[model samples]
Structure formats: C-alpha cells, structure tokens
Target: MSTSTISLDHVVAWLARFRELVTEQQSYLTELDSAIGDADHGANMVRGMNAVVEKVGAAPATAADELLKSVGMTLVTSVGGAAGPLYGTLFLRMGVSAGPVAELDGAAFGAALRAGLDGVVARGKAEAGDKTMFDAINPALDAWDAAVAGGADIAAAASAALAAAEKGRDSTEPLVARKGRASYLGERSTGHLDPGATSSTLLFQALADTVTS
Candidate 1:
C-alpha cells in the first residue's frame, strides 16, 4: 500500500475497523466503565460506530471532509453520554481542518489530527493526567508528529501513534481521575483503566490497521 497519502477509502476502512474492534471489545469496555462509571462506554461506542458506518455507507462522500463530517454528525446524534460530544467534536474539527480534499498527505493528516485533539480538549476540558481520552490521544498525536517529522510514512507514523496511545492508556491506570464520571470515585479510580483512554487506543489501532493492512 502506498503511504504517501491516505484516501477516502482509507478513512472508511479505518472507521470500519474501529467498529469491528469496539464490537469485539464491547464487554471489556463496559466492564471497565462499570468500575468507574455508568458502564455504558462499550455499548455506546459500538452503537455510535455502527451508526457512523451505516451513515457513511448510505451517503457516499466525494471528499475527506464530507465523509468525516458525516461521521461526526452521526456519532453526535446517535450516541449518548460524554463520548458522543467529545468524539463528535474530534472528528468534526478534523473534517474542518482537512477541508475539501479527496486525500491527505502525512503533514495534512497530522495537522487534522492535531486539530481534532484540540477540539476534544475544548469540548471535554481535559488535559494530560486527567485520566480521560486526552491522555491517550495527546500522546498518540505527539508520536504521530514526531514520526512525520522523521519522514515516516503513514503506516510507520500510525504504528508509532498506536504504541504511544497504548502507553498513555496504561499510564491512566495509576492516576486518580480528575475529570468525567470517574472523578467522582476519587481514589477509587486509581486502579482501573480508563474507559475513554481504552476506546481512544482502539481509535488509533484502527488507523494503524487500515494503513498497514
């Protein structure tokens, strides 16, 4: 596969892979959430991603922005809880940053990812160590930028991002929650892995799979 640029097909595959992963891990996600939240993270993500894939399939998009925006809107409307708005904001901002394009080069994709991360922060008001999705996403993007700076192609960059995301996700396990429903547990949140970070890891894993496969 050519790594110089990622096309709309790549994006669509990424979403499909994400949906597959979330469905496979739905029970694990819900179990993690049950320990620190309302126990709906897995089911909500599965439902949302299923809707996103269906919506995208129904309305074929000619451009990256159009496709991404459709995905964002579908998730926002179909999913419930914080996951809907935060994930929606991420994809919405990414689409806006990508503009009217059929494909994205490494730099363009990285910039769009950064924009999405910033949007997530704005929507969730989460920072590093907040034990939220930001922990995983931020580090993942940082590694992405670094890989791009080293002239790595999309596959390599995505691999780097996934590794960083997993590390960040693991890092969340020891921290006391400072945001979202987990925060209510205080010290009780210390031992369980964060549902948001875990799902965010799946997001990158899907990206990696799409590019490498």
Candidate 2:
C-alpha cells in the first residue's frame, strides 16, 4: 500500500503493540537487565509504555509525527536510567524525520527509522558491536533497506527487519559489554544479554506485527 494510506490508526496500533509486548516480557527483560545493569530496564520500559498508551488513549494525536513525539516524550519523562533518554531520543528523531504526516510508506518509514538510529548513535556513541541497542536496530534497519531494495512489500520488509533484529539481540548474549552501564562490568558482562538490545528487538517486532496484522 501507499504511504498515504498509513493512517494515524497505524501509529496508535503500533504503540499498543509496544505496550503489550513490553508488559508481557517485563520479567524477562528485568531478569536480563539485572545481570549487567541496574535491573530496572523492563519495569521502567513497561511504566513508560503504559504512560504512553494512556496519553494516546486520552487524546489521540491526529498526526503520525505528533503521536511518535508524544510517545518519545512520555518515555523520557517516565522511564528511569539510560534507557529512557536513549530510546526517547530515538523516537524524537523519528518524529522529526517523519514530519507531521498522517501516513508513511515502506521507504519513508525506513528512512525515519534510520534517522532514529542515528539519534541513538549520536546520543550513546555506541557502535554495532558495543552490545547496545544498536546491535539489534542497526541490523534491522539494514535488512529493511535490503528488503525494500528487493521490491518487497511493507509487511514483508518489516518481517525481515524483525527477524534480523531478533538475531542481533540474540547475538549480544556472548558479547563483552563495551558501552553504557554494562561496560562497567568488563569481562564479567560477557554472558548476559544486553537489555537495550532486547527492548529494541521487541520494538521492531511490535511494529511489524501491528502493521501486518
């Protein structure tokens, strides 16, 4: 479908999915986080996403960019720890790149997501192998770009992206921490999965499921 056909409903649906997924995986996320970081990533994310859902439900935004920006701001204000600012900035940049639109096509959405990743990089200064969210998000965006270049539909492209993200998240388990709180642990962080990578993977999975279903 065309980008213009992606209504505000799509954005709302994606947010809902984000809340649901994070809530469902809260314990797992927290467990993973506790190993390397402060152990509040999952709980913090759930709290932030729930607040986002409430905000969206109370006064639904008409524009896609506005809705995303609202989500980003809510996360920034509600969630604690480094995740709050990192993820918050990601969405804020996404909103800016998306502009005040009602809809977006696969290519436009991909570009907006890439912009978000750029923001994450700028804010965190973490590279792909740093065992951060970039590990998952970077590969996911790359896969999406590849899928789009291959003339895949949005749903197909999103699916590919999610798969790549999941793989990236999984791959972080054996990595030595190189950024953020986990890096403080040095070699001690080698066996644990990165909480940020896990959450980032969930975010893309939610987006893929929401738009396709």
Candidate 3:
C-alpha cells in the first residue's frame, strides 16, 4: 500500500476506462432507466462518453484540467436530460478542483472528487436517500475521504470508494424516489434502481480500475 501521485496520464487513463465501461453497460443503464425515467440514460451516457473519448484521443491535451474541462463541455452539449447537466457539472468542477499544471495525489484526488460531488449537489440539488446518483456518489466520496485519512494507498482508497458506490447503487432498488422525474411516481418508483446511480457507480469503478491497473 504505497501512496502515489496522480498525473495527467492517470486522468486520461481513467477517462478511457470510463468510456469502456459505459459502452459495455449501455444496455444495463437503459434498462434501469426504463423503470424510472425516459429510458435513455444509458444511450445518452454512451453517446457523451464516445464524444469525450474521440476528443481526448485525437489531441491528447497537455493540461489535465483543460482535458477534463473539454470533457465536461462535450457532455453538456452532447448528452440530454439531467444526466447532461449533472455529469457535465461533475467533470467541470473536477477540472476546476484539479487546477492547471498541478499534480494530484491520493488525497488531492479525493478532495477533487468531493468538490465534484459538491458541484453535483449544487446543480441537481439532490441529497442522499433521494434514490438518485447522489446517494451513490456521496457515500463513495465519504469512503474515499475516510480511507485516505486512514493512510490507505490510492488503490485501496479507490477500491473502498467503488464498493461504497456499488452498495449505494444497489440500495436504490428498494427506496421510493424522492427526487427528479422518478420522484413523480411516488411509491411506483420503488423496486426499480435509479439509472443515474448505476451509471455513477460505473464511473467510480472505472476510476478504481484505471488507477489500480
């Protein structure tokens, strides 16, 4: 368990991992959406990630924050629905948190992620137990923070974060929606997992896998 610094290469690698996972889980995300939303969350994320990959692959920007900001802008324009704004804001805030030309270590990465989560909260105004991505994301950030505070290595901290995210994603299945379009269904939203949370979990998994890899 050695602590390592995060570099621009790591950021790009994680984005690549995210692209792969989103593509692989597209149908799964759509299925989750079919239960609660417009049924396009998966497709939207896939489309957005594809655009992001293409952008990142073509030029390979030198600046990590600029690269992430580009990703955020691409998603904002390409993706539709709350996913567009929420995910866009997350990346945008992450880019801002990382700043220009600054290296991010395990603790810095955790802090950046927490900042991104705060941006999500500001943009979506959703909280934990709302049957939204916030449920997964918040717990994941908390776990990351706790693990990092406990002197866990980046890999171990990220693993813990991803596990918390997955559990939070699963927990969404039994809860009635308390936010977003699904909330409109009241109790009918029960028994269906939130598509947003599922995708968010995938995002955390991608981060953990990329960093560990």
Candidate 4:
C-alpha cells in the first residue's frame, strides 16, 4: 500500500476496523447515549456497520465512490434514528466527492472527508459546540488538513485526525447539548460524553489503524 494514497482496499479495511471498534464499544456507546439521548446509538451503529460490511463484501465496488455509496445507502435503510441519516449522508457525500477514483491521494482524501462533514451539517444542521458528532468530526478534519498541508502522508494525517478527534470527543463531555435528542436535556446534558462524538472518534481511529497497518 502506498503511504500517500488510499485505495479501495484501504477503504474496505477502514470500514472493517470501524466495525470492530464499534462492536467492542457498543455497550460503552449505549452507556453514553443513555445519559443524554436514546440508548440505541450503540446497537444502531453495530447493526448498521454489520449490514455495511455484508453489503460491501457481497458486491465488490471498483471505485471508492461506489463502495461508500453502497455503505451510505445500507446505513440509511437499515439503521434507525438520527444516526442513520447523519452517518448515511456523511458516506454519501464522501462517495460523491471522491467520484469514481480507484485511489485517493492525501489531498483528495481530505476533500472527501470535508465534503462528508459538510453533508452532515446540511443534513443535521449541526455546528461547532452543538454537542453533536460535528464536534469530533470538524476538529478531526481540520487536523487532517493541517497534517496534509505540512507534507504528512496519509498515515500521519490519519493519526493526527484520530488524536484531534479524541480530544474533541472528550471536550464534548462538559458541553450542554444544542442539537439532536441530547439537546432536549438542556443543561442536564452536561457531564456526559456525546455518543455521536465517541462513535465519530472511533471512525477516525479506524482510519488511523487501517492506513498505518
């Protein structure tokens, strides 16, 4: 594997790693969600990612976009609650931004990630400090871009993104919710980690593990 580029195989491995992480952290995710939102975030992610793996495994995609589009669609149809649509739109926009490429260089990968974040914003109306997935994803993408701008390879960028994402996820603990079901809690939402942010951090951690392996 090229250190500076992401291939379709890399994407597949990324999803696989994400599946593993989410499965391992399922109860933890549900614990987080139970504090401020519905308790199904963990189960929903595991189910969605399982369906994603099965769908992508059965139908081989020649292009990154095709593979991810399939993943987005599967999540949309299979997973319930806000996670479905938000995560679905993220992958959907990533695929669209990635186009029909067989490989994405660092810059292209960052662009795809940015597009995905934008799609999530468009779909969920989330912003900085919303105590949503955007909190983790936005900082992660910014770190990714910065690493790439500093001439880091894909693996390095992914590591930076994961680190930033973890920080972002932790930062959400003290924030009052302003979006999603968590928002319904108002100030009561404070002191609990955002399940979306925790899962979103796993997403980046999976990427880091995949590219560095």
Candidate 5:
C-alpha cells in the first residue's frame, strides 16, 4: 500500500494545529455541552491543549512516543471530567504502540490509532452508538484503515477519516445518550449533538490539516 510518512515534526505540527482548533472552537463546544452535559468540555479541552503546547515548547521531544506520552500525561493531569481520561488514554496507548520510532508510514500510523481507539473503549467502557466520542473515533479509524487498504496516502486517508468522523458526529444527534453525564438526560439528550462527538471530529480534522497544508 502507498503511504505518507509522518515524522516527529509532523506529529508536533498536528498537535499545534489541534490545539489552535480546539482553542478557537472552545465556546462552541461549551455551548454544545451545556445542552446535556457538565458544560465544561470546551474549557477542559482548551486548558489541556494549552498545557500541551506549553510543555512541547518548553522541552521538545524528538521521539514519537516521548512527544505523545507527554501529551497524554498532560491531559490526564490537567483536563477535567470524562474528556480528560479518555483522551489521555488515547494518547497514552498511541505513544506506547509507537514505541521509540521517529516516524511512521500510513500502515504504522493506522496501528497506533487502533491502539488509541482500543484504549478509549477500555477507559470509557463505551462503544458505537453510546452517544460518545467513540462514535466519531471508531468510524474515523475504520475509514483510515479502509483508505490505507485501498492505497490512499496519509493525506487522503486523513481526509477520509475526517469525513467519516463528521458523519459519526452527526449520527449522535438522534441517539439517546447511553454514557457519561449526557445519559442522565435520557430522551432529552436526543436531537442534540454530542459535544464529545463534535470535538472528536475536530481532532480528525486537525489531523487532516497537518497533511493538507
């Protein structure tokens, strides 16, 4: 399969782009969460990403695992509520799977992503149709795998992942929340899009931006 090789530089660039996107969209995310959640998804995410940016800038990590592990640990400590642990686990697993590598091809990156998704599932105890970030993340990973299998490069695969993530995020609107605080609202959660799912889409979109730009 054809692949786009992603270096440590690309990983750093991706994180920076993700931080900017999350910061810019913070209020929108908070609004979404206010409908059915603790209403701090935006604040928590922005705070965590800002910490990540600060850490990265202070002491740059040349190895892939070192950089991602730092991102994971920062989120785990700083971000509040469910988003923190879930995203922290995602990065932690990805870092472990990435080992000490300096770069990854599309296939290797896909494996790392699969590990991250698994970590989310394990940490969140959620699955597809749970009306959570898993809805977006699972579909994006699937699409990324399929795209790579179909010979798509990193940019194309990331684009496909973003598209699938959007569809997954949209799919959550009609779902009755089955996990997290949103589940407390039951049927009231129906018709409102999940903040977690929306944020998950933003994550994939940032990943795509790293390649496209």
Candidate 6:
C-alpha cells in the first residue's frame, strides 16, 4: 500500500476522518466557543462535516474536483455562521486548484493546500496573531510547504502539518481576539483557547490520520 501521491480514495478518507474528529470534539468545541463566541462552533462543524461525508462518501468521485466541490457546496449550505463560508471556501478553492485530476502528487497537494489557505484568508480577512483560525491554518501551510519541499512523503508532510497546527492552536491561548465575534470581548478573550483555532487543528490532524492510516 505504498504510494507517493494522494489519490481520490485518500481524499475521501480524509473527509471521513475529519467528520469523525469533528463529531467527537463537538461538545468540546462548543464549550470553547461559549467563552467567546455564540457557542455553535462544534455543532456547526459536525453538521457540515456530516453532510460532507454523506455526499462525498456516497459515491466515489470521478475527478478530484467533483468530490471537493461537493464538499465545499455542502459545507456552505449546511453549516451556519462564518465557519460555513470559511470552511466551504477552503474546499471550493481546493477543488478549483485540483483541476480534473484523480490524484495529487506531494507538490500538487501543497499547491492545493496553499490555495485553500489563501481562500480562507481572503474570505475571513484574518491573519496570524489575530487569534483566529488563521493562526493554525497559516502555520500548517508553512509546515506543509516545508515538509514537502524537504522531500517528505505525503503522510510525513501531513504529520508535520498537524504538529504545526497544534502549536499554532496553542499559541492562540494568550492572544487577545482581533477578529470575529470574540473581538467584542476585548481583554477578556486573552485567556480562552480560541475554538476556531482548536477546530482548525483538528482539520490537519484528520489529514495526517487519513494519510497514515
């Protein structure tokens, strides 16, 4: 089962693993959000992820774009609030970057991931140190690019990305919110670990699990 590229099957597995992780962390996510947000981060992701799996898992995608597009559209429609649009934009941009391929080599995957990260930034208008998902996502992209450039396999690169994501997520704990609903809390946002950052970390973890599993 040795492979150098991420095939459609791998993408599907990534989505499935992500769904499982989000569902498992739903309550924890909500609890994290309760301190700073509307308290729906967990449920929104779970609902969106479930729909993504139901759609993408139901049938094997003939092309990578097909599956990714389905996932993006589903997330945008099913999930509520900013999470839906931001997450959906990620998949949509990934789909666009993936083209019609059935598999993605390490470099191709990196490019697609970078595109997805850029899309989130464009849609969210947030950056690192903003105490938002960008904190995790930006670092994950840097780690992914570096890992792949260093000649790591997709699995190894994914693991690196996840580790970076975790570090980014943790780094959010002490920062005061500069964006989103949490911004209104001002100084009060400093102590709480950002829920968006936490969930974004899960996204990379799911990618690593799918590649290694």
Candidates in order have lDDT scores of 0.94, 0.89, 0.88, 0.95, 0.91, 0.90
Candidate 1: RMSD over Cα atoms? 0.7
Residue 104 in candidate 4, Cα distance off native in Å? 0.2
lDDT of 3 by residue, 146-205 (tens): 988898888898899999999999999999998888988899999998999999999999
Candidate 4 clashing pairs, residues 3+ apart or interchain: none
The candidate that achieves the highest lDDT relative to the unseen native structure:
4
Per-residue lDDT over 1-213 for candidate 5, one digit per residue giving the tens place of the 0 to 100 score: 233798888888888898999899999999999999989999999999999889988998888899889999999999987889999999999999998999998888989988998999988899789899999999999999999999999999999999999999999999999999999999999999999999989999999999888
TM-score of each: 0.99, 0.96, 0.96, 0.98, 0.97, 0.97
Candidate 2 global Cα RMSD: 1.6
In model 6, the worst 10-residue window by lDDT is 1-10
Per-residue CA lDDT of model 2 for 89-166, tens digit only, reads 988998999998888877888898899999989999999789999999999999998988898887788889999999
TM-score of 4: 0.98
Off by over 4 Å in 3: 1-3
Score residue 138 of candidate 4 by CA lDDT. Answer: 97
Candidate 2 has its poorest 10 consecutive residues by lDDT at: 1-10
Q: How accurate is candidate 5 locally (lDDT)?
A: 0.91
Better of 1 and 5 by lDDT: 1
List where candidate 2 sits over 4 angstroms from the true fold.
1-5
Cα deviation of 192 in candidate 5 (Å)? Answer: 1.0
Error of model 1, residue 6, in angstroms:
0.9
Each candidate's number of clashing pairs is 0, 1, 0, 0, 0, 0
Higher lDDT: candidate 1 or 2? Answer: 1
